[model samples]
Target: MGRYACVVRPSISLVVPVFNEEENLAHAVAVAGRALAEFTSQYEVILVDDASTDRTPEIIRGLTATDPHIRTLRHDRNQKLGGTLRDGFAAASMDLVLYMDADLPFDPREIGRAISAMEVTRADMIAAYRYDRTGEGLRRAIYSYVYNGIIGVLFGWPHRDINFAFKLMRREILEAVELRSEGSLISAELITKTKNLGFTVQQIGLDYFPRTRGRSTLSSLGVIGKIFRELIVLYPEMRHPRRRSPQPAVRPAEDRAPI
Candidate 1:
């Protein structure tokens, strides 16, 4: 029998959005290799360099050269985190998708956990929840409070971390919810929008860790202001059911033109 003739199993596409984090990229890749390879051999790891001004793009190129499974997409202009994710998601082609922070704050073992949960529950989405908060004092507390409170009140909680980066999702769910929030708060935007569509999703508690390098992009003033804006702007979509969820609707390169 040909290799393609066996019973087909769904595969994973791990999408890691990269900015200017040269220091942390290698560690993230290593963890992915250790944790994800056991699940499915037909998987792909997509690294997106969102027009990093630093060595991030170079680092990504190096990884791609050594690993055929590692695919990369680069943006010419510096798009923020959300834009990077949008670009990354568009390029992905797999049955299952995994998106996470490259800084190594969340546990990678949760990849196996999330996939297992999806298989058992047949849930469209599996989100990773932090059992304990990492990082330091007030910033950690404030971030948790702001996002958790907003998520609980605005959307339906019981899910503590709406913005948790580690998520395992089906291609249908990923395609259904069109991702657009082009900044740090895209996680909240994704969770709320997905819940509205009735995706049968669940959260699994996870181990959190401290970032040893690469400064966080979230600022005290910037984050808070953005939160309020999201509540006002993005909240209404949650109020009423949208006709359909976001999915991939791609066009030829020639079609995307100024003319």
Candidate 2:
């Protein structure tokens, strides 16, 4: 930890949530280690195992034993992606927080770009955008329309790829927003909240990869139906001031602009 302090830029905490991703867990972790290695001189990787039912936890143990920068946190039972991310966020010890997928859907190397974007641009959050994606072609297309349209039109968030799990957030923004969704939609919620809070956001292009194993949780019709319901009922919860325990800390912006 001491050695990392000198070189790690803003102390990065990489939070990856896992649930039954044992097959790809090790690969994701390995890529994260390599990417973060080039990302900065110092950093810590936190693997949040959300009660995996396979060898995921065992693999995590092995990973921790070999890498000092890697550590594992376990959830007794399945907490779902949202819960896993919340747990990871709570356990993060770095000033800059990164949340990514355990399925290796995005290029880990883009992490360096995100870190650089934040440091150089003075932005509080960097959201990664995907050019081409995977999964059932129709389903991914539907997801794009639902998420991007809703957040852009209703919430007015300056976000392009709301479904992307890869994000770099400053500690201040992390502490400010209370993430409550136990599923994937929380990704969109975070973008909406940050924009509503008037935080500066930057989007960067990222490589999208196909998932070889395991299946996505939602179908095209299934996701569209769910998000629409969430749109009406969840807006309040997402923007809830009471939900964020201490409330979002303000940095006294020199000028407020539309997000």
Candidate 3:
């Protein structure tokens, strides 16, 4: 028998949140689909449109018309990153769920390696950090450094890139963790709660690719203020999350790799 003939590939739900990404949506989805096929045949690409005011809706319709594996959900109004991902996670019917941004921050081909890491380490969630981020610019780099430091101090997890939009997890983790943040803090909330609730999270390092086609407003002062306001309102709950229903036994997190 072959060395890997018995390995079972898990089904996946690739959740992508988009706003005004008409230029990148179609191409990104196509690339993701191809990459996903390299590992598993059973996968769905869920495109969550957060009330985009562009040709995004038309593009989604065209994609669904041609690809049966592609699915979409749209909001009546802008709900930001948290709400969009919440809906996508709810609609996902797979054993595993992976979240990526519309701009394609990392190579989709890396998806295979992440899955391999999860299987090898028996990790409940896989969080990816960039090997290098200097291409994104100085202001964002400073923001990332400070934000990561604060999260490390408060959460005590020492996660390298809490806000980076590259995370993969088993479906059960999302089912057990109730996420409430409606802004960028959602990522931090997800990672923090998972760590506190006794699930194993493993980190991987990947090459960073900054957005080249569209403008990124995630680093704007307005967004930063909203994240802070949310942090204040949701601090207590995040610090001490109420455990949901019991989950299956998880292995000790001692095997997790360093980023």
Best by lDDT: 3
The lDDT, on a scale of 0 to 1, for candidate 3 is 0.85
- Which candidate do you rate higher for TM-score, 2 or 3? 3
Span of 10 residues, lowest total lDDT, candidate 3: 250-259
TM-score of each: 0.85, 0.84, 0.92
- Per-model C-alpha lDDT, please? 0.73, 0.74, 0.85
lDDT of 1 at 100: 82
Tell me the tens digit of each residue's lDDT in model 2 across 42-135.
6788888888788888888888988899878899987666678888888887767898888888877777667667766678898888877655
Model 2: which ten-residue window has the lowest total lDDT?
1-10
**Candidate 3 Cα errors over 4 Å, as ranges:** 1-6, 245-259
Spell out the clash pairs found in candidate 1.
175-246, 175-247, 176-245, 176-246, 177-246, 178-246
- Write candidate 1's Cα lDDT for 1-259 as tens digits: 2222213235878898887889999889888866666666478989888788888988888888988889988889977767888787778888778888788777676666666677666677888877777455677767777768867776666567776678887766667676567676678777776777776678888887767899776555776676667567767775555634333453332352110
Return the lDDT, model 2, position 20.
Answer: 81
User: Rank order by TM-score, top first?
Assistant: 3, 1, 2
- Cα displacement (Å) at residue 210, model 1: 2.0
Choose the strongest candidate by TM-score. 3
